[model samples]
Target: MSKILVLGAAGKIARHAIHQFLGQEGVILTLYLRKSGRLQKLAGDSVEVIEGDVTDTRHLQEVARGQDVVYANLAGDNIEEQAKSVVEALEAAGVGRLIWISTLGIYDEVPGAFGRWNHEMLDDGYLEPYSAAAKVIESSKLDYTIVRPAWLTDKDEVDYELTQKGEPFKGTEVSRQSVADLVVKLAQDPTRDVRASVGINKPGTDGDKPSWY
Candidate 1:
């Protein structure tokens, strides 16, 4: 059984991931969110709900105990700090597997007009913190796979592709379901993409920006 702790459990992508794990054999979910009330019903019988902020090291470590995998789906200006706190808590708890969510532009992996448009659209507020968080996770001793997705959409489709850290990132928009499916894959098999930062997007969606933009 995989004991998975999902930080930012109430988040869009995280919600999709939670649903993906439901009814699956040997999968137990711990939903950790600042406001978990909204997610209580979603937890069902296979989930343990914890209400708290990801930046709280004490709470993070407490919940992180015995977790086979830690998946963080967090955002905000303090994302760098939040990622640092998670890494520290996991280290303190001796947990080694982490599936961290990041954005495609965090590593300047996008190219051409898309790259320019992605940066201009996100600016520093989004790019800076996310990139900073990715750096923290990459340098950690933990076995981590940082999954960077392109512009996310509310669409439910699961079509997606992988772009290695050094490879040029593709696509302009991908469904939240697509990103969550990757998380499910990584968490189910800890050794799948260890110590790598990968980019994900729907194949053939590449353009100046996402279709919605």
Candidate 2:
């Protein structure tokens, strides 16, 4: 059985991941969120729901104890600090596997006209911190997979592709479900993309910018 803890469990992507993970047998799940009411409906008998801030190392360590993998679907202006806190808590708990959801432009991995547009759209507000968070995750000895996804959509589709680190990131948009699917796969195995940063998006969706942007 795989033991997993999901941080930022109230977010859209994490919510989807929770639903996906519920379908698996022999997978034990713990959900960490600021408020438990939002995801309470999905808790079922298979999940343990806890309410707490991810930045609180004490709270994080409490929930992360005995977990084999930590999946984070978090976003914020202080995301770097949160990431650092998570790393600290994981280290304290002696847990080593982490799967973090970041964004594509963090590494300027997006190319051509789309890259320029994405940068202009996000400015430094999102890029700087997310980039810093990635650095923190990589700097730690934890077995980590940093997932950078292109502009996310609410579409229910699951089709997506991965752009490995050092490769130009592809596509402009991908579904939230697609990102969740990848997280589920990593959580199940926890060894597929250890210490690797991956970029995800739908193929052929690249353009000057995401259609909605």
Per-model lDDT: 0.90, 0.91
List the candidates' TM-scores in order.
0.97, 0.97
Give the Å shift of residue 134 in candidate 2.
Answer: 0.7
Clashing pairs in 2: none
Model 2: residue 160 alpha-carbon error in angstroms: 0.6
Pairs in steric clash, model 1 = none
Candidate 2 least-lDDT 10 residues: 37-46
TM-score for candidate 2, residues paired by index: 0.97
lDDT of 2 at 179: 96
**Tens digit of per-residue lDDT, candidate 1, span 91-186:** 999999999998888878889999999889888588988888999999899999999988888886889999999999998988999999999999
User: How many pairs of residues collide in each model?
Assistant: 0, 0
Per-model root-mean-square deviation over C-alphas: 1.1, 1.0
